[model samples]
Target: MSELIQTYWPMIVAALVLGVAVAWFVFSTSRKTRVTGTSRDVLDEGAAPAERNKALIDSAPAATPMQPAGGAAATPDATGDDLTRIKGLGPKLAATLRDMGVTGFAQIAAWDDAEIDRIDARLGRFQGRIRRDDWVGQAKLLAQGEDAGFAQRYGKLS
Candidate 1:
């Protein structure tokens, strides 16, 4: 029994030492790097309103006035109604539509069920809203310079 213990004791000690060494090496290597304020300072405090505004302006696409809620009015550029003009479209869905060749309302209105289904498959969560909202018909009316049925249905147009 003593001989057996002696024989394995060195192996056990060596394994313990190796485990400690590996643990220390892993911990030491995982130390976080200190980030200098260079990147953060550029974006953080002391930024002037004009500079911030300019940065925002530069980062953002050129502003188009948002259409009224429920797409009550036609937008200035009649060529293509902005899909994002719909109230429900978030940035992600709008981008998805753009990816699916649905850049305009006319395109959406012109799309058959198969094409819309394809778009819906890509859009996932936005599918139900797109179908329920009648986005295509609204888009078509907007494209045709109609007052979105307010004049006809309500007897007065905005």
Candidate 2:
């Protein structure tokens, strides 16, 4: 084994490097931006007049039922709130969710663990985000109009 390793060390190193490259590509392309500690915590929930972290709409087309953007599609049908308001969810992911028929907080809040797993599977690269960011917990408060509660835990969404 030692003699073989010495003879083929370059090959082994190259294989390891290739594997690392693939992993990096897979992870960087699929995963959403990481959440910061400050961004995750709601600093102010009581300040109704103050609107922080307002929804940033992309330069996408507005259509009924769904507004598709050029790349990062923004906005959903009349019933849907800005899905990007949730932490770890960016414009691209929001568009993907919209394509999957996930429109609003109500829809997300209603997802059971089983449903989350099912949905997560279809997320392609954005898998496991639902549980990781605790979207359901945030959605539950948002769905119920509990801004204070949401702000208290998951931060404010304008």
Candidate 3:
């Protein structure tokens, strides 16, 4: 047993670290509430980015989680624009953006240079992808319904 402990100590230590990380992630996520604007439905559709951001900032405190009277969650939480439509963005990146309160093409399209830099700093391994992939350009095309141009530039969207 003593010999085994010496040989496997590194693995045991790694497992313990992983366990702590998972627990911290779970606890942190559970404690974070989704901040929303006065009209999530309207804000997500056809609205310009600056207007949307302004509204969200002004109305964030008034918004609450959408729990139906019937004790079920709202459908909006599960719905958003298909972010994967942008070529370089994968599932993990999309989830990270969602966690950061991004949901629609319009939202991403609206990011200014400052916002891009700010967001890029938080992307960890995905840093610079927003600029490298031209997320704003791709999102602009999609948000404006330029399918042919988007397909030509970034491949076909499903």
Q: Which predicted model would earn the best lDDT?
A: 3
| Candidate 1 residue-wise lDDT at 26 | 94
Q: Sorted by TM-score, highest first, which candidate order results?
A: 3, 2, 1
Give the clash count for each candidate.
0, 0, 0
**Between candidates 1 and 2, which one is better according to lDDT?**
2
Model 1 pairs in collision: none
lDDT of 1 by residue, 1-158 (tens): 99998989999899999999999999998896776665444445785456857888779576453222233232334444455655456678877665544566656666566655666676676667767766666666656667756245423432
Q: Is candidate 1 or candidate 3 better by lDDT?
A: 3
Which pairs of residues collide in candidate 2?
Answer: none
Q: Mark the regions of model 2 whose C-alpha exceeds 4 Å error after superposition.
A: 1-79
Error of 3 at 114 (Å): 0.4
Number of the predicted model whose TM-score against the real structure is largest: 3
Q: Kindly give the stretch of ten consecutive residues in candidate 3 with the minimal lDDT sum.
A: 66-75
Q: lDDT values of the candidates?
A: 0.62, 0.75, 0.80
